[model samples]
Target chain A: MDYKTVLTTCTYCGCGCNMYLEVMDGRITGTIPCKTSPINEGKLCIKGWNVHEFVQSPKRLTRPMLRKNGDLTEVTWDEALDFTASRIKSIKEKHGNDSIAFLTSAKVTNEENFLLQKFARAAVGTNNIDHCARL
Target chain B: MIEEIKKQVRELLTSGTIKGFLGLREIDGHIAPYLFCDAEDMDSMNLGDYKKPGDARYPLNRILIHLLSHYPDEILGVLVRGCDQRGLNGLYSLNQLDPEKVIPVGIPCPPELAEACECSRPYPENRAVDGQAEGYSNQTLARIAGLDIGKRFEYWMNEFARCIKCYGCRDICPMCICRECSLECGDLVGKGDIPPENPIFHLIRAVHMADRCVDCGLCAEACPADIPLRTLYKKVADIVKKEFDFQAGYQPDAKSPLNVLDQ
Candidate 1:
């Protein structure tokens, strides 16, 4: 009875396909392409169509995990960040910075993607920066 | 055209002939599917013309299916284009929808919309709007058919390669009401691969659509890859017509040609 559609743009690609997230009983249930948008014109790719699936998925990573004895164990923010920084530093020192790489996602904002590339080029001294959207 | 339809609906609602009328409504300049009840606002009622004619076509038949399940005993009024009427007939033949439970208020598509869709039947049998629009011949299917076997394979492969495997085509299809889909079967489709192993993934769906495609073209419209799905589905429909002499959803009382699995 409480079904409604919330209009929004797709976060998976630069195409900016507009879509409606169908909310039923306060839970995100499905995705319907926005018909009026000139960009997509009532069409959606696979990623745009299934954008709601991962929102409340049980497999989603809520806490940071660190590889301990070949097992990913959940850890606090400070501990995980410290571990990551130390690992990156050691890897940079052991091998050239080019050996390491940074991969960003389309899910994040433009500023966050900019920060990631900045971290790779200026902070980490590596130009090995890439994006999940294949940009 | 919309006023006459609205007037009829208002009369039906006031008389308690139907529990609700399912149609598109323009809300804050955006159009979406809405169910109108007794004494509701008729000004917002639309014939799915947001930017242009036939632009905001939702699967009303599909939505009606869901609505009927929630309110099993009540009769609901639905707006139907020629394509939608066919879908209703197909659903009826398959026993997915009880013919007695819903009332379809039909409308003919505008000539521009009908031509854009290349729909052979642009007017429903029972119509609220009075108009005649010519149904275009199946040119896309004929164009594809003109190609030789090798060129046909190359043409289809190039089109299929653009597929992101988004399943939007299936999701948007009104005929695709099956709870269990074969495309999701890992053993058959092979998981986590883009383009979904080419023609097989598409062919699997095409085979299923043979007996039930109402020629709505929503799947092709929903496909982000622009995969010419309408052409493919139309070809399947043509094959079914040729081989079995059956046109789905076209006949009033005829049952499905393939009744292999009953609902």
Candidate 2:
């Protein structure tokens, strides 16, 4: 009996069309484009219509992974972050700062992307930065 | 028109070519889609003149597609008019509808209905039913084309503002087949607000509809707010044909530009 449309921003791209995820019985059933919003005006392209598929997908990542013997093994955040930092430091030391590049994702928030670039420029000392959109 | 459609459905049911016939039925003084399984059930199959026949064009296409999706081998006969036929063609192009399994019973639209829909051609090119009237024309494109660009934009803005976001247009569209829609793409359109974004939701759809829309007026009918979405998409289709030298449903040999690689 949990039938309600939770208002949320579309995390897909930069246009930011307003919509509601229809939650029925705790299951994301469908989506409805917001009518009162000034941008989209209650119309959705094919993508907006099926925005809930990725959220309920089984393959979405929930935890960090570390590769050992060419196999990725799930690990704690502290272990994963420390491993990443040490690996990056070694890579910079061996190949110079120019060899390391930061590839960002569009799914992350603006603040996270900004932080990633800052880390790449300030900490990593590399201007070779790119985004997921290119690859 | 109602009586003629009923008689044809009755004949088709008795003809034994189809086990079930899908058409419109009267319910509580309104017309809604119904599946006439029994020949006697043709009594309830009401066509038009009931609740203004709000978007009856897409239901037959949906019913046929639904049947094909679940019962791929089963043969179901459908009552198709000009718009419905075009929709069927679009669906067939997308492989959503199986041409061999379903029988199309074409119905010629009357002059008044044609005028109401603002359709260019009211009769389907293919007809299985007998006594269908000649195709009629109501040139909505010419009128829209004659308008200035600014006026047209203002007109579309006002019309789109009345949208209720029921998604009846997308639900009823036969050509729109994607697990995820661009309109829903939060990347392009933001989430959580009424009226959504103005031209983004609609403009994105228009871009997607470039070579797909069959000039069926179901989107306009499905719009609870009576937005003239058909006119806008019709313009888009026109642009596609003008630029790409392509028209949907006119030729089975042709492929929609969106599906093919740019080369």
Clash pairs, model 1 backbone: A46-B166
What does the lDDT read for residue B162 in candidate 1? 91
Q: How good is the docking of model 1, as DockQ?
A: 0.46
Please list the C-alpha lDDT of all candidates, in the order they appear. Answer: 0.86, 0.71
Q: DockQ of every model listed?
A: 0.46, 0.02
Model 2 chain A worst lDDT run, 10 consecutive residues: A34-43
lDDT of 2 by residue, A1-135 (tens): 123356666776656776667564577856655544455544565567678888898998889999989998999999999998998999999999998988888777889999999999999998999888577
User: TM-score, chain A, per candidate?
Assistant: 0.90, 0.90
TM-score of 1: 0.81
Query: If scored against the real structure, what TM-score would every candidate get?
Result: 0.81, 0.61
Those runs of model 1 whose alpha carbons end farther than 4 Å from true positions after fitting are: A59-105, A108-135, B260-263
